[model samples]
Target: MKVLVTGGSGFIASWIRKELLARGHSMLVFDHQDRRQQLADGEEFFLGDVRDATAVTEAAAHCDGIIHLAAVLGTQETISNPRPSAETNILGSLNVFEAAAQYNLPTVYAGVGNHAFRLIGTGCYTITKSAAEDLARMYNLYRDGGRITIVRPVNAYGPGQSVAAPYGTSKVRKIAPSFACRALAGAPIEVYGDGTQISDCVYVADVATAFVNALEYTAVHGPTERPVEVGPIESVTVNDIARLVAEQAAILTGREPVAITHLPMRPGEIPNAVVTSDTSTLKQIGLDAIDFVPLDEGIRRTVDYYAQTWLPGYLAA
Candidate 1:
């Protein structure tokens, strides 16, 4: 099958592209930026934006299905600049759904698990993502619309995640990359609030597998009635994550554990946020046999990636 992957150059989409290629599928990658130096054998990159309906429609042609991953990410970034986020997350998603309906394709949408905790977060990212999910549900109701399956993933983290700006292009501050980079640099790890806030961190590879599984299921069984939740059932506190990163970095770099400093919670972020999910839907989609990467191991790999790829450049400068 040939798949149209919006945001194909992104962190998660990079894994999805690999998964697709491994499963004997071809990809038509559509993104505004041209990030690839060389395309994989079965992959084709198209320079376009999801916000451009014509571009999206043009890219959807000749594809068997769509995996819509384009969006304005980062809670703090979106809160500070909600207009662009809304335009991209909401309007851009609408374009993708419409294009899918027009092409009669199966679509797997990337949604945030934080949508379930909207009242707690109340941020622009959550609001826009929630709207996009609603659009998916609405589009699925069309009799002639493409089969649309929504996969709601919790905090996705692993290697390849960009560190916060000045070092990377990502405007959002993700926990794993932030902590791992700081710990490796021997800088203090900053924890928001009292560090009791809970997050369910899923490895990027596992999240990619869940997405491919969801896409395959939708291809065969049509749109699922409920959003398929992706992540481990277990949860970890922010402080726990910080300490874990510190420990992993200490082991890798032969440095003492870094201090974890508590700061005021940022705008559009939830305090003490806990993620609760029902992953029976994942089982229903034939992901029952999969084992999630343990948090400790995931962090170890993440810290190691940064220590090799990102740390040298960071430390030298």
Candidate 2:
């Protein structure tokens, strides 16, 4: 099968591309940026924005399947600039969906469970993403453009994960990378609002595998609009995440254990957020809940990746 992955330069999208290629699928990466990973003989890239209908349609012509992963994410970024977030996350996504409709291409959409649990606190990101989800459903219903399966993932993080850091911005709102970097530098692991807020930190590789499974399921079976929740069976509190990252970084860097500090809760902080998934539903799509990477081990692996690959260049820059 030939696949077109929008936002292919992104961390999770990169992993999806790798997973697809490993399954012997030819790939065409469509993104505004250049490919971060080198393309193999069967892979190619088309540089363009997802908002451009012409560009998206032309790109969609080159593949049999589509994985829509392009979005402007991050609470602070969305809060600071809602217009761009809406334009990209909502309008850009519409372009992709419309192209999928035009081409009658089977598509797998990446969704967020946070959008459904608005009690956790909603922001511009949530609003736009939620709207995008609605558009996906509309396309699935009206267009009859092949199959579209929506998979909502929770707090995806691991090696090669890219936090929401725009070029001219200094704020890093993501928790995992922030904690990992601070720990490696022997800085205190800072938590907000007494560190009680909970998160379902799913491993990136596992999420990638889920995407592959989703693609395959749709390809073999047919279009199904039922949303599939992809996340861990367990949840970890903010304080536990901080402590675990600190401990793992200390071991990897040969540094003293870092202290966990508390700060005022940010505006969009969720008091407690948990993700629940139907394991039987996941199994139908070829995913098993028992395969999720444990939090402690995920943190260790992430710390190692940062220590050996990302941190050195990050600090020097």
lDDT of each residue in 1-317, candidate 1, tens digit only: 89999999998998899999999999899999997675799999899999999999999987999999998887777777889889999999999999999988999999988896566666787898888988888877754865899988888899998888656666778889999988988889999899998887888998898888888888888988788888876777889999999999999889899999999988877777886556777876777423888888899999999999998988788
What clash pairs does model 2 have? none
User: On a 0 to 100 scale, what is the lDDT of residue 130 in model 2?
Assistant: 80
Q: List, residue by residue over 1-317, the lDDT tens digit for candidate 2.
A: 89999888888887888889888998888889886467777789899998888999999988898898988886656777789779888888898888888888888988886776554466788778888888888877777674688888878888876543431133546678888887887778778778777667888888899888888888777655477777777766788889899898889878888999998866655555545454456776867878888888888899898788766866678
- For candidate 2, give the lDDT of residue 115: 72
Which regions of candidate 1 fall more than 4 Å away from where they truly are? none
Worst 10 residues of 1 by lDDT: 281-290
Top candidate by TM-score: 1
